[model samples]
Target: MKKILVTGATGQLGSSVIETLLKKMIESQISIITRIEEKRVQFQAKGFNAFRASYDDVVSLENAMEGVDTVLLISSGDQGDRMQEHRNVIDTAKKTGVKHIAYTSRCLNNRNTLANKLMVEHFETEDYILSTGLKYTIFRNILYMDAIPQFIGGNIALERGIFLPAADGKVSFALRSEIGEAMANVLLSEEIENKIYNFTSDKAYSFYDIATALTDLSGKTVKYTSVETNVFEGMMKQRNLPEPVILKIVDFITDIKHNQEAGIFNDLEIILGRKPSGLKNGLKTLFGL
Candidate 1:
């Protein structure tokens, strides 16, 4: 059996991708590479093969990818030194002679905005992956609708109903399950090598629409308050959010709301061969409504 290894299996996207792959492929043929042993155990209990690995450690990565047919490098969440971390994984995969390499990247490759960090990293990653002369697929994932609950919970805790710096800009946020299926399709298919798959929902919506969705789902009068970037930063500070983190986050939000770069794509539906889940269905599952 050919083994397909997934790095960062503890993360939301990675875990979902692994589950989707195993459901389609044999359990023994799917592997999870993670830094945490507990997470590995969870995969083992689910009848998956797990390997302890990290992006920073080249040797561990090589060992994890050893004899594996395909690899899905879920981009690291670490802000600092992430590029080097990704490079290490790519180099290790090359050395291990993996058949196909797939990466989860940002929605757009334009570097004209602050929300383009992932885009930059992904472009670099794609370049490096191609340089290795291996069969590769780049999944340029859009914003996830799974983030709604977290944003809503934070707003409620801060007593700031639908608080954000974004104005009328729409984000092409995709459902986790939809992305999972698309990734699985790419991983399982042998015909898509040397392809760049831009995975996003067919539609886009502003945060105000998000707030309205919440209100409609739970009957909570959540108001969309578009504050100035500085004002939003101050609000986060008032809520005792860490200074450095809030500064970066506020700047990202400012870019989106200011129309620096924001829109939707039909890539998800194209890849999955079906209509991707929308914001309402995503919220329904998230809120259990």
Candidate 2:
């Protein structure tokens, strides 16, 4: 049987892709590269092929990719030097003579955008794959909406009949599961080739749209407050969040306020051969409303 290797198998995205793949093929043919030894028995019990590897360690990568025909590299979340880390995997895959490698990238490296910083690194990784003259596909995923959390004070406000933090900026949020399914389709479909696919839901919504949904479903007077970036970060710090994480959150919000652009809707539907799920549905799933 041809082997398909999935890197970062213990991660959220990697784990979902492997689950989807198993629905179509036996786990024996699905190889997972991960450093966590505790998951080895779990994968073994499920009949998956597992290998011990690390992106920072080239020898570990080469050994993992041995005899693997295809590789699905879920981007490393290690924001520090991610480009070089991804290069390590790409180089090892090439050395192992892998036929096709699929990379999880972002949509549109549109030079002037803040998303560009994130997008460009993925592009660099894409460039490395192309340089090797290897067959590849790119799954450019959008933001996942399921990861949102209610602010700490929002609980008291909800009890007091006041919902807060109505961000006015528009957001194009897609479910991670949808992206996972599309990645699996890309891996399995023969019709797709050396090309790039931008994965997003059909609708792009603003923060008010989310607020409106929350109010309608939860029957609570939830409010969306548009606060300055500094204020938001200060509040998070006051709540005892770590400085580094708070800074990342602040930077992310600043990006959203200034650079959250309208996203492409067709690529995801076309790839999956179905309509992508809507934000309302996602909200309902998350909030039980």
Candidate 3:
């Protein structure tokens, strides 16, 4: 039996991946590594082997990898020093003689002209993972449809407008749950190795499309307003968003404006064995109506 350890086990993606794994594999074959003791106890209560591991603590990570054959090294949430954290995980995994690593990364249409500074760490981490000479699978996930609500602000119905810096570029957003399921299936399979898979929806949607979907779903007139990057930053600041977060959002929108996330790929369908959910359906699910 394969002993698979998943990092970030309490996170949304990680939780969904575990849900999927529970159906495919026995509980004893799975382990979870989390920084929080409460989450570790929660998993343990459910009969899972859970460990306390922090990305900043190399010794904890090495101990977590003991007797584990495969690891799902989910990307760290911290944008500034996440690459270093990922390096710690990858290096420790290598030291422990782990067989395979499935890393989650961002989809870059063109790495050479990547406008999103937040994505630089992902590209760099991929390079570092490759350099370690370990068998790995890089899942280049696209923007999540689950994030549209946050991107447009929580109350889009009340706001009646979609404010963004993205000009008219389209993005292929996939459901986070579906992406998690596909990732779990990939981790359980043995066919793919040392390959990069683009996990994106087949259809792409611009902000205008998103606005239209919102209008139709909510039965209200919602419009997409394209603003300058500085203006967007000012609006975010007015909302009491932190400076670092505002900058990250601006960079991501700048990438969208440059059509850096417009690529549509079939890998998601190939992995899921079905067409990925459409944006309208995703929005409906997200809005819960």
Reference-based TM-score of each model: 0.91, 0.89, 0.96
After superposition, the stretches of candidate 2 with alpha carbons farther than 4 Å from their true spots are 108-111, 115-119, 150-167, 259-261
Residue range 157-196, candidate 1, lDDT tens digits: 2244776778786777888778978898778765655887
lDDT of 3 at 28: 75
Clash pairs (backbone) in predicted model 1: none
lDDT of 2 by residue, 149-225 (tens): 44324335344442223355455778888888889877877554798888877877766677677777778876667
- Among all windows of ten consecutive residues in candidate 2, which has the lowest summed lDDT? 157-166
**Regions of candidate 3 where Cα sits further than 4 Å from its true position:** none
Best by TM-score: 3
Clashes of 2: 5
State model 2's lDDT. Answer: 0.74
Backbone clash pairs for candidate 3 read none
Q: Mind sharing the TM-score for model 1?
A: 0.91
Superior candidate under lDDT, 1 versus 3: 3
